[model samples]
Target: MRPKPVKPKGGQESVWDYPRPPKLEEVTKTIEVYFNGVLLVRSARTYRVLETSHPPVYYIPQDDVAMEYLVPSDRTTYCEWKGRGRYFSVQVGDRMEQDAAWYYSDPIGRFGPIKNYLAFYAHKMDKCLVDGEVVTPQPGNFYGGWITKDVVGPFKGVEGSFGW
Candidate 1:
């Protein structure tokens, strides 16, 4: 059964209202990721993917991320809207989160702007922030969308929400 969506208040956006195929929009606000007290990424220019039933996933440019901390992983996944994704393992000191980040080397025509950009799993990182506001990780293991204040939903990615 599909869960009823929560009513959005205070100018919030409902994930249920987002498009199925998803749309890419450039983010002008600051996007930051930190792990083990170290800054992994900080960028003013990023792109956000908004899809139905999911919070936005911000994709950071390769130049803005701490590339040394990311190691290429053999894992890969396919997204109907995007293309095949390549994974990356994040390492800070001795701690490592395998396949914690992903990027599409060659995206579909509509998602071409995000090609080669990286999006991290919020739960795997110590913290992720948008414009200084800490973000909540979207539930479940497979989806990597980040929840911020402006977005509202009974979002997908939680237990019992798989069919959404």
Candidate 2:
């Protein structure tokens, strides 16, 4: 059963209104990510993938990220819309978050714009900020969507939403 979507308030967008195939949009907002007391990345040149029943997944350019802290992991996952994704474990000092980030080196179709851009799991980070507002991580371990005040949802990745 599909859950009812939350009604969007002023200046807000409902995830249900997002596209099925997903849309990749360039974002100019200041996106910042912090992990293990380290500023992982902060950039205005970022992209967000918007899909139905999910909060936007922000992708930061490789140039802006602290690549030294990200070690490639053997794990990989395939997305029907985005193609194959490779994982990265974040290691800062002795603290490591395994499979905490992912990216597509060669994206399929419309997702090519995000090639080599990294998307971090908000739940794995100390905090992720969009336009200065700290975001909440989307529910469940499998999806990495970032929920902010401006986005409303009965988001996917909840316990009963596997079929959404």
What tens-digit string does per-residue lDDT give for candidate 1 at 1-164? 77898889887999999997899999999999998878999999999999999999999999999999999999998998898999999999999999999999999988999989999999999999999999999988678999988998898988889777
Worst 10 residues of 1 by lDDT: 155-164
Off by over 4 Å in 2: none
Angstrom error at residue 70, model 2: 0.6
TM-score of 2: 0.98
- Per-prediction RMSD in angstroms? 0.8, 0.7
Report the C-alpha lDDT of model 2 over 16-112, residue by residue, as the tens digit: 9999999999999999999989999999999999999999999999999999999999999999999999999999999999999999988999999
Q: Enumerate clash totals for all models, in the order shown.
A: 0, 0
Candidate 1: TM-score?
Answer: 0.97
Q: Rate the local accuracy (lDDT) of all candidates.
A: 0.93, 0.95
